[model samples]
Target chain A: MKLIPYLVYLLLIAMHEVIWRDVTAIHGVTINLAAFLVLAVALYKSELTVVWFGFFAGLILAAGMPDRLGWHALALSAVAFTAFHVRERINLKSPFAKFLLMLGGLFLHNVLVVLINQSGGFLYLVWHSALTGAVYTSILTLLFFAFKDGYVTVRKIRDIF
Target chain B: MTWISRLFSRHSRNLHLVAILLLSAVLIYGNNDLNRYVNRTTLFFSWPFSQVRCSIEELSGVNAENQRLQQSLVEASLRLTELDEIRRENRRLRSILEFEPEPGYSLLPARVVKVVGDKIPVSAVVINRGQEDSVLVNQTVINQEGLVGRISEVWPGGAEVQLLTHMANRVAVRVAESQEMGVVKYIASRGMILENFPIQGNIRQGDLILSSGLGGVYPARLVVGTVASVEKPEEEAFCKVLLTPAVSFSSLQEVFILRPD
Candidate 1:
């Protein structure tokens, strides 16, 4: 609910956008860090918070990219909304479920981006780029979740002291 | 019953989602007006990252530079032999006809700042130079090896170059040895393909390919690539030619913008 966390998320997204191209690109496929972040927030945060996070994160990414401005915002918001609804209906406590959610979110994001851009060879693009990117982002999401959990545990121990 | 309380009611979340989506749709519709400003702002924010990218490139470029230098040395030796043959031919041709060679063009040096759209096969790269340096859209970009790409968009302090490897790019090129002309295009995973050349034409492996200046987009005779392989399919009217680009896109760092006087 605090504005500070939202601003911090935006800042992290901005920094990720700047460096991810160089650090994460492999064989022309890159991890969609923004999408992963959106999914992570959706899984952990309140519905309203996740929705706003998705929109703002998408906005930050769209601003930096050359694609049509709203594509990312729309995609992220939709994915976040879906993830939030899914979270309400099901238990997403399992790592496998979280990974699947991450992949689905990234895939939906990529599909929206391609469609909005009206890029030619839609099927080929989805198969080659979207799927690969989803897998890469999902792998990254797993690592991020592990790190976050470890950090949370460490904080809890420190609080007890 | 206050307006503020109503705005924060249960439906407020849906309202926020709809509002954000609507705003995004509006922005998308009116993107042209905001694109330049957004790109400039992004460029400003990405400056530090660009510096870091340059530093990393510098650190890693040493081995690549050494390999390139060694390769160039071998090429120089071969060129020396070719130059002697060309000199004799030039003398013979000059005696037969009065002609003048084309004047050399000056190059505006620029450093690459970022590569965009890495997830897709087609992507553009951002360069440090911009309109301030007289860099214009569609201007030819090259490095020491050969043609890199053409300027696609130019902002005040930066420009985006659509690399020849981009699927949308179609280059008018000619075989240097035989003067056979064709259009070179990128075919996703297949690299550069020179199409529309007659199967019977003198296209062959190792023949130099250069920009023919037919489309008026690029200058005449800029080195594009070499005929990597020539395939004459029995079913097709034209030859299937692959090119090994003169410039290695992966190792691209410094490039020159050819601004014809």
Candidate 2:
């Protein structure tokens, strides 16, 4: 059962890497599906599991990117760990809270990656790409969460009827 | 000792976080070697997926063919005028001397495999050709329409191209008609902006922009774009000129890497 979830996560990461290029991009900001996945996992899993999963996911992403090698791994791990701790204190069961968490996580990830790589034009990247990416990723996370969990509430209402 | 054991039990998460951070530091320290290995593995894994994407793109091309044909028609018209000028110049040079026009550049065709940061204003695309195909860093990339970008990173089987519109990218360009030189830089919210042209320079809307060959990276006279709008601020020493890229980046599928001889 544990193996199944891990395989699913791996599959999601692989699919994200392949299909993300095709996603509709607005001003070059697309939904960060990988970041969303990390946040989702953190909400449900233990701190240790989330950290390892994030690290591995980041490692996989760094493989395709041309930037510094461990930047993504480090960024993702840090974001996941932060998200896990935040989840313990917050009401992440709510869609709004999840969206907020994802927004912060994605922004942090982008900042870490940019800073680690020492990419120039920091202001332009932050204002144009990072913020837009955070908003877009947050919207995507909300939709995904609703799709995955909203059905349960709908089914319960149907049973009541 | 009991208290120490209790602290470990209660704060194990903190320990794990520290351990991961240390691991991350180690990885960063050995980043160069690890980057090569990771990039190789990524290329190996993503190769099949790239092929699949290519196939899907081909299938979708049927619907896009009409649009491409229309674009080709426009490009053909532009090419005709450019060819006529070249022919006149060649004839004039031939009359003056027994001269053989040097073949300036050769084109290596490559397929775009992956696009990165498309949603972000800072963007790049990965092409199928790499060092094996002699695709080197700083080589100019172009489609039939016009300039696409420049190759930034090259591996064995793949390469990454930093698009001309990327924030960090700057190209030296000149107005074709006026011969006024300027540096084209990508500005956020705004597209490509050509700056540092003299305020008195006669740059106008629809003026063609070409690479000035001032920089060693891109060759001379490659069509970069046209001046979409020009702003002559009264207080500033330079004119702020906005450019509309000749090549449509959103629809780019195939491009040629120019190998200058």
TM-score of chain A of 2: 0.83
Query: For model 2, what is the alpha-carbon lDDT of residue B247?
Result: 74
Task: Write candidate 2's Cα lDDT for B76-170 as tens digits.
Answer: 99999999988976764454344222278877878888988747554789999999998889988877667778999999999999888788788
Q: Which residue segments of model 2 deviate by more than 4 Å? A: A117-120, A151-161, B1-19, B42-45, B57-261
- What DockQ does model 2 achieve? 0.24
Global fold similarity of model 2 (TM-score): 0.46
Candidate 1 CAPRI assessment class: incorrect
Give TM-scores of chain A for all candidates. Answer: 0.84, 0.83
True contacts kept of each: 0.42, 0.44
Candidate number of the best DockQ: 2
iRMSD, all candidates: 2.7, 2.6
lDDT of 2 by residue, A38-151 (tens): 888999998789998898778766666645546788888889989998899888667778778888998987777667666679877877777888888888777678878774
Backbone collisions counted per model:
0, 5
Q: Highest TM-score: give the candidate number.
A: 1
DockQ of each: 0.23, 0.24
